[model samples]
Target: MPLKYLTADQSRAARGLLNWSRVRLAARSNLGEATISDFENGHRIPSPRKLAAMRQAFERAGVVFTAGGPTLSNRSAGEGGVIGTQ
Candidate 1:
C-alpha cells in the first residue's frame, strides 16, 4: 500500500510536539535538512521514500499523527520525556 505523507502543517506540528529541530529529524530520518525545511515550508513535496523516512522517524520517536493532529504516545507523554533525541 502507498504511504500517506503528512501535510506541511502536520509535519510542522509534529515537530513542535516533539520539540525536534530539522537537523535532529534529518539525522533520525537520514534526510537532508534542506529537504525537510523545504517540505515544512511548503516549498516542495517529498517523494514517497523521503516521506516514509520522515514519518517513520517520527513514529519511532513516539509521535502519533491523527486526523485531528500529531500527538505524543501515551507512554512517552506519561514519562514526561517526549524529547526522544538530542
Candidate 2:
C-alpha cells in the first residue's frame, strides 16, 4: 500500500515535538536537508521513499501523526506547532 505522507503542518509539528532541526531529521532519515526543507515548506512533495524515510525517522523518535495533528507518543504536543522555516 502507498503510505500516507504527513501534511506540511504535521511534519513541522513532529519536528518541534522531537526538538529536532531539519538537519537532524535529514541526517536521521538519510535524506538531504533540502528534501525535508522543501517538503515541509510546501515547495515540493517528496517521493514515497523519502516520505517513508521521514515518517519512519519521526516514528522512531516517538512522534505520532493524527487527523487532528502531530503528537509526541505518551505526551501532549501543543497545537500551533507552525514555525516559519521558510
Candidate 3:
C-alpha cells in the first residue's frame, strides 16, 4: 500500500483542525510518534486507522471532513496502492 495523494498543505491544515500537538495527536490516535511526525512533515503516509482518527478529531473540532480536505476513502485508496484501479 503506497500513498497516492496528500498535498502538503492539506496535511498541515488537518493538524491545525485537530488542535493537537504532534505527540498528542499520535498518542490519541494510537500511532507511533514518529509515524505522526512523518505524516506532518510529509515524510510518510498515514495508515487507515490513523487517518480515521484524524478525521474524527477534526469533526470534534467542528471541522467538516469533506472533499476539500483529505478523506478516509482517498487515504484508503492511496494506502492500498490502488488509486484509480477501480
Q: What is the alpha-carbon RMSD of candidate 1 to the true structure? A: 5.6
**Per-residue lDDT of 64 in model 3:** 42
Candidate 3 Cα misplacement greater than 4 A, ranges: 1-8, 68-86
Query: How does model 2 score by TM-score?
Result: 0.74
Better of 2 and 3 by lDDT: 2
> Model 2 over residues 20-73: C-alpha lDDT tens digits?
899999999999999999998889998888888888787777665554433334
Give the Å error, residue 82, model 3.
28
lDDT of 3 by residue, 1-86 (tens): 32333333554565654445777766665677787678777797676767767545444444443443344343332131111211
What is residue 15's positional error in candidate 1, in angstroms? 0.9
Taken over the whole model, the C-alpha lDDT of each candidate is 0.72, 0.71, 0.52
Report the number of the highest-TM-score candidate.
1
Cand. 3 Cα-lDDT: 0.52
Model 1: residues >4 Å from true position, as ranges?
A: 1-3, 70-86
Per-model tally of clashing residue pairs: 0, 0, 0
lDDT of 1: 0.72
